[model samples]
Target: MNIELVPERQYQVFNSVAGRHHHHQPIWQNIKNLLKSCFGTQSDSRLLNRDGSLIDINRLRQNINDKQQSYKKRHITWPYLLNIYSPSMTNSDKKIYQNRARIRYNRLKRTWQERVSQGDSFYVTLADTILKDVRRTDRHIKFFKKKKQILFNIMMTYSVYHPNPGYSQGMTDMLTPIVYVFIDESMSYFAFCSLMNRYMSSLFDQDQIEINRRIRLFNLILHSIDNELWNKINVNEENYLYVYRWLLLDCKREFYRFNHVLRVLELVWINSISPFVISQSITNYRSLFTIFICISILQEDRQIIFSYSNDEDLHKYFFSSSSSSRSHRSTKRILQQAQINYSNYILSQK
Candidate 1:
């Protein structure tokens, strides 16, 4: 169970059971596939057969055309503005729609640029982290680097292995930190793969298993720790959902203290003692403490959170709370309580 120390082959078997078809591949191959998928041609069919033949091209085209017509009628497009200038639509409406489109596209472009830049940073930082850890004198660092390389090769070969779930922005986000910490590309890759295999089913599809798992654990812990607050939150049906941002990024987006985040991760790893801790915590009672910890953090910043009615304020609060000492203390208390409950629960189970 000490995955960090076990032989590579043992975990290789565990990985296979977790549904990975490849544990090794060339770096160039993964990069090639990623490029192809991003820029290559794609199918236009709305539906497809088992073998991938188009099932409804005409209907799909018709649907697209209908939507286009609807946009025209609603004065929501460039053509609609042309009509307005030609006296078909009023000047006021024309200016409004054009401005809206310009504003929307500008915003979209800004977001795209940011994600692209972040993705680039993530890739470089991850690669550097892996290489740096490998060069360190620690013996664990060396072995970990070997394993990480295997995983890296596999990821590079992702297109040939799991074509349907090829590289995603989130994948890079998940991989970067592991590579930095572990230094072995293969080990980091497998660790990340192990994690993704266990939790990412909800990511690419509509299956709510992962989300439900979080909600259930959140409810269980809230019910255990503070029934009064639990009842209040439940009445609003917003316990786990309120904490969605934290879960989505593994608390990277929420916690300001890197050391604190690592401690929480260690607690989670120890509590569930499962590699699939993120998702498993959703169903395990011990995960309740994790949610409680989150609530405690937020409650300490109640004024900051509730004071903000819009995104700008929320963003400001997020940065502000990251460095706040008061909130950090509450987080530590929550973790301590979680440990007490976890110990009590284990004793009772035995």
Candidate 2:
């Protein structure tokens, strides 16, 4: 019943039943087609998402007119996951909207920037801890060379609002691709809040029980796939921490820039909206899908990963700069593979 390792092949569409398609298709197209049903077969044409919101067809289209009108818009591209939930706005309205958002962005930016000087114990404490993590996390937010302050401000603002598990170490890793995709602090912050509130909050819990449980599930599923590979890579139980890092950070630093990570995230969010998961009331689907993604990536580097007998070598092979650039696999293909992996895991259980 074990899922066998897959060799490289042409990209396939994600499917739980067939696991492959006869012809190749753009990943976005499949996701777009599923908009109406991802939430489930509602009697109304109104497609619902995680929060009972309607999906906007026009925004999903990224229509030619909208693109033409907003050539000079702040975000040149809108990620599908973010756009699906965003309100439709004309160019003029978007300009006004962004201007207002810019005002708020600046206000928060300065408010947190003052934390170092204000000497307020609370803000100062957050400021000191935030700055340390920001410095390290900023190292390879490749698209964020000059905008580290924006990253800092977003985290600071989030900390102020959420307070629980505010500004954890790996949060910056999750936020970088979001900010890059939205290219606007306000949109990024809002989207980040949504993700934290629903799908990914478990990763941020201060206590370790939920985190450990999920990692245990990851190890359990991985062992089910192949006990030998699991035992090899998971020596000393270190791969649990590695998987935790991947899950918590969205594996953000593992690629050339944020593009791969964003695509990976796009797939993750797509799963969050999946009818099978949502209709079945699978509250932990996001964490579940993300674990499959971790496995997909691990399986890709299997040959090289297997060569490394020790955790340290595997660690470098995973996170080292040279290793980062080593992935030639399409993000879409990896995601499709995850679909197969998840399906096979489910079948094996039965």
Candidate 3:
């Protein structure tokens, strides 16, 4: 029983069972945060255990149900939960994952360092846009203020890889909380890639249809979760601008402290298991859950949203510099409401 092992079998078993039971969610979430500290939201692909057994991709597919259904029904005091042979591992395992993550991080940095030493950004065309966003993104945060160039380069690198739309305005807003969380540029970039490629690609899509598609979906989400607000508001192009801003910035402006923003961002990133692997078969978890998050913000500020006559006024209502307005809104309330909204939408779909 070497505790320092990254057993693929145990990880698979943990994946199959971890968050299924509601009672386990509190501890499970803590474990997940600890893992994120080591892995930076990137799924560790070293899927071999002490016995040299390989990972089974088929078993991983059972997760959508495990995530949705397990919380619906709680099974307490099972042998699986109590057995010493369960999926739980040790701090040494954390050290192993952390070490590998550093290796990956350093390797990526070396490659970038070589290119940087040669004065090659490879994002020459897109640098201007990325730079402008980086300059003004988060000046209040000391790290963001100091590492402006690094943030600029990360977005530039992303542009070089994903040249479709190159770069957009609010993309930096999406990157801010991620960089803050990972606190390492290389891991942050990879984590950012996982997040964007997951369900957020649409918001940056060129045809502009996908962005609109998300707006339409938002209306459906709003209708489902808060019909009162939905009925009160007119669903038109004018209001779509509001939703567009929300999608682009990922509701970062909704919260006062950046920690609250990190919580929501991690909420979207945590449910995602295969961070590096993009699969069409897996349901779009980020897409659906993100909508619920937006709705939660809107629901929290329902009175403010309705009290204002125009979008301009409502925009100022939430985004105003007065931190008090945003501070009162609880992160727990936002998350709990989001889950409730998601559950309602899921039940309605069935």
> What tens-digit string does per-residue lDDT give for candidate 1 at 103-165?
643454355346436777754554454444334312232334455444444344332234455
Best by TM-score: 2
- Residue 73 displacement in candidate 1 (angstroms): 65
Best first by lDDT, ranked: 2, 3, 1
Model 3 local distance difference test score: 0.62
* Distance from true location, Cα of 306 in model 2, Å: 2.5
Enumerate clash totals for all models, in the order shown.
13, 0, 0
Instruction: State the lDDT of candidate 3 residue by residue for 283-318, as single tens digits.
Output: 456666777788888788787778887766755664
Please report, as a residue range, the 10-residue window in candidate 1 with the lowest summed lDDT: 75-84
Screening candidate 2 with a backbone cut-off below 3 angstroms (N, C-alpha, C), the clashing residue pairs are none
As a whole number from 0 to 100, the lDDT of residue 89 in candidate 1 is 39
lDDT of each: 0.46, 0.64, 0.62
Off by over 4 Å in 2: 1-117, 274-283, 310-332, 346-350
Q: What is the lDDT of residue 320 in candidate 1?
A: 49
lDDT of 2 by residue, 1-350 (tens): 35565444422323432445545456646866687555543422332234433356443333321222132222433333554234444445556766776687677767756775778898888877887877877475466877687788888888887878676778877787677668677778777887787666767888966677767777877887767778777665554566667777666555553556655665566556543332233436567777887787778777877888677887676556564445675566667788799877656645
Off by over 4 Å in 3: 1-125, 235-237, 272-283, 309-312, 315-325
